[model samples]
Target: MLRCSHVLCKVDDIAAVVRDYRDLGFTVEWGSAPGRAHNALLWFGSGPFIEFFELPPVFGLLRHPFGLVHGGPAGERLARWARPGEGWRDLALETDDTDLARARSALRTAGLPVSRVIRGRRTRPDGARVRYQYLASRPAGLPFVVSAYDPPQRPARVVHANGARAVARVRMGVAPADRARYAALVGEDRWLSAVPAATTGVLDVELEGLSGPLDPRKLHGALLAAAREERG
Candidate 1:
């Protein structure tokens, strides 16, 4: 079964985004190195971290190549439809294996839009390398599938100043015709709750914590809230 991996937010400034999120009690990590720095990861240490990134000024000059890959090209499809200031672009559902063919087959049989597999890899800040692959469709705002080629290097748990634990709710605004497809993508993970919309995209994300809602404007249009009780 596939589970929500992580969500992407297109932003213009990594520094500002980090500052804003930290001010809001989150432990935001800059996921890129200097000079070519273009992203930050909102790591909750568990399920679904949030990735806030921006395309290069000269992104048009980049190329998308075939076969196993490293860096920029692989992420080209992710940023293709996103604008710098737009929040909550695509939601990725994940599998434990690197080959997404099985997942793609299921999606297709279920009548969901599934693209050919694309693989990628990158080194983490600690120098650990990670490999992954995913399936995506060209639809403007639909969820996608991703899988790790090897064991994931991300932390299994973390302490958030805000007392966050998990993603409690993802309120999605989806197209009526694609409702079933979206439903078939996830299992009993009730994180996603959908409402019909003129278009398909994330409407809000409710994190499992004890804080109030955030200002969507600061979040580039993603309406996020922390709404879970702290356990003793």
Candidate 2:
């Protein structure tokens, strides 16, 4: 089965996001590059991570045919998925060759629109290369089927001021008709529930361990919170 890979959060400015997340007491790893990276990430040493990215007008790139060649069908879908404004825009599901084969077969067996292998790679600030591939299917709400990273990037530090250890769960929201399918594919839990919502996407994200609330105003109404862990 597929697992929650990462939640894509779109921001107007990458620098502000890195700074804000850092201020929130979480280690933010620059995704694109050190000085001019378009994205940054928050890793808690385990589980899924949160990716913050910016999609500013790329000098008339998307409007040109060469851009389409560069991004391909999957890339076009990603660009279209990320609408204007801030907050959680998209979600991804991690899969290995086994899981990908299973998911690929399942989609074909069910007559779903399956995509060709789409690969992408990026360079880190330190000059290390990060690469991965995935498949996209019909229906905009479906998460991308991403492959496991060979050598996943690590943050300079995983330590956080808050007691947040890892992603407790992601409270996902989907169309009522699509909830069951989503639940079946991604599973349901306190954090990763595919509940019914008017809008289809991530409803909120809950990080494990914390007693107080974060300022929603600063978060741009992204609906992220930290709850005290329930010990049995």
TM-score leader: 2
lDDT of 2 by residue, 1-232 (tens): 5778888887888898777767777667888676879888888777788888887645225533633553344555555545568988778888755236667677567665656666677888788888877777545566667877756665545877766777887877788766555655566433466667876678788887753566665675467777435332
lDDT score, candidate 1, position 168: 74
Q: Count clashing residue pairs in model 1.
A: 0
Judged by whole-model lDDT over C-alpha atoms, candidate 1 comes out at: 0.69
Every model's TM-score: 0.80, 0.82
- Those runs of model 2 whose alpha carbons end farther than 4 Å from true positions after fitting are 57-76, 98-103, 154-157, 180-184, 187-191, 228-232
User: Which 10-residue window in model 2 sums to the lowest lDDT?
Assistant: 59-68
